[model samples]
Target: MHELIVSPYMGRFVMVKPGRKEGGTMPAYLYRELAETAPTSPCPDWLVKAARQAWHTELEGRPLAPAVLVRDDPGLGYGRASWELNLGCNYDCEHCYLGIKDFAGLELPERVRVLHTLRDAGVLWLQLTGGEPMVDRLFTETYAAAYDLGMMLTVLSNGSRLFLPKVLDLLTERRPDRVTLSVYGATEESYDGLTRRKGAYRLFKKGLDAGHEAGLPLSLSMIVTRHNAHEVPMMRHIAERIGAPMEEYTNMVPTIYGGDETLPTQSAEHLRRRKPFTGCNAGHTFFHVNPFGRASICKVGRDPAVDLLAEGVEGLSRLGAIADSLLLRQGGCTGCGLQGTCGTCMPLVQLYRKAEAPLATYCQHREKEESV
Candidate 1:
């Protein structure tokens, strides 16, 4: 509220809001510290750096309390949609929620339609995701179209696909705002064991190397699980190796393509309990759209409650019903220490708490997933 919370990369320049400066810009020295301190969302240290700089400048400056502040207002946040571009991936991982299902049946024209539909919804920031975005049929085309339309695009990738001349060309054309790569095992055996595919570790590294040589802005992520939670430092080392920043996420329950409210099969059952992220309108503020026109407010929730995929763009604009469904932070959230500390998913904690760990699913068991 007083001192601007900024990324280490930025100094006090523009202050987006009057409140605490968590995700906004700061001096270059504070990026890592700010990334570790920010309450939610970890993309890249530079992402935080850029956001911090923008917040005080182009972004909405500080929230004003009306004499009688109404809840209907935009408040201190923003709305965004996460569209799973294609389910198919170049590699298969053991904890992959979509797994082989990402490659399921889907018409090519239909997939393209989804992009246009999302564009129509006035989505400012669009996320292209899936088993692996590089494997998508129209990935290059889609990127080109989105970039031309002035939509800020972010891609979730494994870093293995960027080496392809065509894919590399797409990156050159779009110059995407962000590319998040998930790394699980630091060693080939660990990464291959989790991915269930050998040589993927090498491929991911090759992609990271290529991206760096090409001067692509990048971010890295890691999911702390039973086998690799202790490997946080190693994961950080990997990020540093690629000249990117890193983030560590507490485990969460998987929504499995937002399939059903079921316990997460791979999450750690018993974790260090600190607090819970509840009462937040995850659906309204955060959105998850699956292939085949399926949609959910919270990316971690299995049941979308509403099917926007079938309903089309108009359905997505009516976000009121979805926002209202979010459970509010009652006692459990306010009383705990980890309340706003860790990156918490409200839909995930409320729905499933398995036998092994409190948080079931984690950044898909990858090192670079902490950004999620």
Candidate 2:
């Protein structure tokens, strides 16, 4: 009988037909490995590739493109979580939302406590993001802790630290479900130039090479700002060389504290705003926990957070209520002439405007949409 395997890491379903060469039987462990790595047994190279392509196509058609699951759980009753392991990072990018400063996050014991809390809350998948999670003092132990909990892990990093022997060993032993490396530049000139750190590009390249060799599932992303926009093509070429797909993002909102808007991009029209603003999974089946243990609907989303350390799963229960409250406060965008055209949502309105009023700067979309 043929078996259909769901790869949570790769987000694809592969059709496996046991080959007749080995007594017409393939072991179950082989299926698991195949699901994770796309091994050359029980399937040809072409079929494996085709299956992956089909899966990505399916994902793009869905409302939440990155969430790959066999079934859709609306409540996300037991779902995915994003952890900002720490606010400390190794590199300082000019357009960074956090403004490129280092600070201590939770202590190691507290971090472990947070992991236990998430696993208990039925959070099976975790995305460990950061100011650069690698720089966190407790990163390795916390990663091991998550792996021990049988939770699928995805790490977002600048890739500079993966070259260390200890880091590589941890990744090789307890392989994360996926690793996404943020590519700063195709060359050292633009990379170190943008980050203002000498030899940053070299370290990033070394990390990528090490990660590729360790067989880690990798992807590349470039935050397209004015300075590095010209190097985007070169970055894509680097992604191809690393055998990882490239994702480019241009819609950079101001920092959570409304710090700066100096980064240039395509246009306000390209922002990720949909009518009625209902596509987000934040505070429902998904939530973001920042360095200080503040849990919100999303990473960029601030205000109305429940302290995960103090509240635990019980606090998480209030997120739905918090979300309901945010949704209720839709403000002027509720029935504006540019409702469908503007990207303003409650969290964004909170970010840029005064407590009682919407910001006219954010309303620039109305004029643009009307003039068109």
Candidate 3:
């Protein structure tokens, strides 16, 4: 396959590599011309110049062509997706939203079919996530398959497995757009205590060092919970030391199955006011898929999902309507004056309601909305 990908992003035409580490934009005329050119045709002078400028590489005669370009499909509207490879994880954190972490998923053959379906659905930006996606046996093979299919991939992990030789080698050779690792604590005492896995902190540090040394693109998600609230500053220092951008997450939500078990772990003092919900293009421009190939509008609003395996890409036709129905301010939120300033979305409100969590956790009607 060619090293570059030329496709339309949202409403604009652009050129990007499969890993998404480098790219630039091209005019609509060039984009249209490339689509009509033969795959084996000579790399035009303009494209060669643009490629050299973007990738900083010199092309040798006919090495690049129209085959590298991704054409738009009038039938498919979605552009991105996230797939939960498996719900299995080595570290069992008390605050994990996926309550029951089971080590179960589709085998390689079926998994390949799912990847193909995603590509056929016009999904270009894809995220591979799970309880811990790295723990899945077919993780590398699945990743390679998706990368080969021209999808810009991202992996969400806890960083405990980045020290593995096979995983490191695969990632170094075929880089992902980004590898987002979650940081639980700055010290072993708090990290291990929170994850309930001894040596978890050591493994996490080792993974971080290995990935950095290998020159992999890395980012951190600082998960602030009651167990590690005191170490927030230390966590920021660690991220700064590593030179990776870090984002802090203080709000704890109910499990995907609507269980209240995770709510007790929230750090009340760290809870921040959420921005008001405006809108999103969940089911229309992007969607989510479970390990079993069930497609949903998004992760939180998962009911009324489409079975990709049974109904194929055509099943996505129902998701737009599903999203519209779910986003309606019905249920307990109906006709509420606070609707204009509500920070939480409808589906998440439903989860909190199902868990019977305190109204202070999500609703704007709570007496003390400042803290959880």
Which candidate ranks first by lDDT, i.e. highest? 3
Ranking by TM-score: 3, 2, 1
User: How big is the positional error of residue 96 in model 1, measured in Å on the Cα after superposition?
Assistant: 2.8
Each model's RMSD to truth, in Å?
13.0, 9.7, 2.2
lDDT of each: 0.56, 0.67, 0.87
Question: Compared with the true structure, what per-residue lDDT tens digits does model 3 show for residues 47-131?
Answer: 8787788776555476455336555543477788999999999999999999999999898998898888888887878999998
Q: What's the lDDT of the predicted structure labeled candidate 3?
A: 0.87
Candidate 3 runs further than 4 Å off: 65-75, 368-372
The residue pairs that clash in candidate 3, if any, are: none
Q: For candidate 2, give the lDDT.
A: 0.67
* TM-score, per-candidate, Cα-based: 0.64, 0.74, 0.95
* Candidate that would win on TM-score: 3
Model 3 residue 185 distance off true place after TM-score fit, in angstroms: 0.4
